[model samples]
Target: MYFLSKELYFPPVDEASFEGVLAIGGDLSIDRLLLAYRNGIFPWFDEDDPILWWSPPERMVVVPSIYKVSKSMRNLLNQNKFSVTFNQNFREVILGCQQIERPGQNGTWLSDDFVASYTKLHEMGIAKSVEVWQNDELVGGLYGIDLGHIFCGESMFSKVPNASKIAFVTLIKYLKEHNYKLLDCQVHNDHLEKLGAIEISRETFMKVLKSEEINFSSSIQQHGR
Candidate 1:
C-alpha cells in the first residue's frame, strides 16, 4: 500500500490493493478532502488506525433517475409522518451517525478528529446533512460530501424504524428533481441494494466524477429548496 505524506497527492485508484486500500497516513485537511472526493476517493479507518484512503474497484451508486422506492416506502411518504430538511443541523446528524451502533462493526470509524474535520466541511458548504424529524424531534439523519453532481454519502443513523430510509428517499427525490448525476454510496451493503443502489466499475464511476458537464450552479440551491 502507498503511504501519503504532507503533499496533497494520492496514488491512482488502479494501484489500490485487492481490498481497495489505496494509501495510508494522510491528514484530513480541507484541501485534501476536497481533492480526494473530486477524484472518487474517500477516507475510512478505525479510531486507532491512521487515516486510510480507498478507491474500490467497484462503486455502489444510485442513479437519481433510477433510484427505487418500495411500495411501503411510498405509502409512508404519502402519510407524511416525517419531515425532512437539509443542512439544518449537520453536526448533530454526523454525531448521530458516529454514535449509532451497526450490526457488524465493533466501533465507529467516525472519530473526534473526523467529526471536527467534516464539520468544518459542512461550514464551508461542501458537506451536507439530511435530517428526518418526527414531531419536531431529530429521529434520523444522514450526511455526506456534495461535489456538485455527485453526492458521496458517508453515514446515516435512524433512531426509529425507517427514519433513515425516509431521509434517503427524500434526498433521492430532491436530487432527481434537481438533476444530480449520481449518489455515491461508496460501498455495497444489503440495505442500499434494497433501495436500488448498484455496483459499477470504478472506471464508470470515475467518468461521472470527472465529468465536465456538471452544473456547479446546481449546488447553490441549498436547504431543501
Candidate 2:
C-alpha cells in the first residue's frame, strides 16, 4: 500500500493491489481530485479511516449510446410524472445520496469533507447533478464529476421506486445530445448492470482516459477554472 503526501501526485494505476487500492492519505483538494479522475483513480474511504485511492482492475462504465431503458421505464418517461433537470440543487441531490441507505453497506462514504470538496467542484462547474422532481418536490437525483467527454458518476438516490432509474436515463439522454463518450460507474452493481454498465480491464479504461483523441482542455475552459 502506497502512502500519499501533500504533493498532488498519484502512483501508476498498475501499482494497485489485486483489490484495487492504489494509495492512501491524500487530502481531497480540488486539484488532486481532478488529477485523480484524469488518471482513472478515485477516493473511497470511511469517515474515520484515512482516504483510500483506487484504480480497480475492472472498471464498470456505461457507454451512453447503449444505455438500457426497460419498457416500464420507457412508459414512465412517456408519462412524464417526474421532471428532470441538470446542475440544479446539487447540494440537495448529494445530500439525498448521502442519506439514502444501501444494501450491504453499514454506512455511507459521503462524509462532511467529501461533501465540501465536491460542492466546491460543483461551484467551479466541474461537478454536476441530475434532479428528479415530482409535483415540485425533490424525489430522485444523481451527482458526479463531468470531465468534458466523460462523466464520473459518484452517487444517486431515489425516494420512490425507479426514481433513480428515471434520473439516470435522463442523464444518458443529455449525455448523448452533448456527445459525451462515457459514464464512469467505478464498480459493478446489479442496478448499474441493468442500465448497461459493463466491466472492462483497467488497461482498456486507461487507454480511453489517456487517449489523445479526448481533450479536456476545452471542457475546463467551458466550465471555467
Candidate 3:
C-alpha cells in the first residue's frame, strides 16, 4: 500500500488496490481532505488503525430523479411527521452516526480524530448535515461533505424506523430542487441499492465530479438559512 505523508497528496487513482485502498496514512488536515475529495478519494479507518484512503473501481452514487422511494416512504412524506433541517447540530449528528450500530460491524469508523476533523470542516462550511426530528426531538440524521456539485455522504443514523430514510429523501428533494448532480455513496450496499443508488466506474464518477463547479453557496441557500 502507498503510504502518505503531510505533503497533502495521493497516488494516482489507478494505483488503488483491487479492494480500493489508495494510500495508507495521512493527516486529516483541511487541505488534505479537500484535495482527496476533489480527486474522488476518501478516508475510512477504525480508531486504532492508520488512516486509509480509498477510490474504489466501482462507486455508488445517486442523483435527483435516480433515487427510489417506496410507497411507504411516500406516505410518510405526505404525513410530514418528521421535520428536516440542515447544518443544525452537526456535532450531534456525527455522534449519532458513530453510535448507531451496523448489522455486521463491531464498532464505528468515526474515531475521535475523524470526528474532530469533520467538525472543523463543518465549521468552515465544507461539510453539511441533515437532521430528522420527531415531536421536537432529534431522532435520525445524515452527514456528508458537500462538494457543491456532489455531496459525498459519510455516515447516517436512525433511532426510529425509517428516520434515516426520511432524512435521505428530504436531502434528495433539496438537491434536486437546487440542481445538484451527485450523491457519492462510496460503496455498494443493499440499503443504498434499494434507494436506487447504482454502481459506476470510478473513472466515470471522477468525470462527473470534475465537470462542473460546486455551488457551495447555493447548497447553503437550499437550507433556507
Instruction: Give the Cα lDDT of each candidate.
Output: 0.88, 0.87, 0.86
- Evaluated against the true structure, the overall lDDT of model 3 is 0.86
Clash counts for all predictions:
0, 0, 0
| Candidate achieving the largest lDDT | 1
Q: Which regions of candidate 1 fall more than 4 Å away from where they truly are?
A: 212-225
On residues 1-54, what C-alpha lDDT tens digit does candidate 1 reach at each position?
998999999988899988888999989899999989988899999999999999
Query: Model 2 over residues 60-131: C-alpha lDDT tens digits?
Result: 877676556678879989998998988989999999999889888888889988999999999999999999
Q: Which is the leading candidate under TM-score?
A: 1
State in Å the error of residue 54, model 1.
0.5
Q: Show the colliding residue pairs in model 1.
A: none
Measured against the true structure, the TM-scores of the candidates, in listed sequence, are 0.92, 0.91, 0.91
Task: Estimate the TM-score for candidate 3.
Answer: 0.91
As for TM-score, the candidate ahead, 1 or 3, is 1
The list of candidate 3 runs beyond 4 A from truth reads: 212-225
Instruction: Give the C-alpha lDDT of model 1.
Output: 0.88
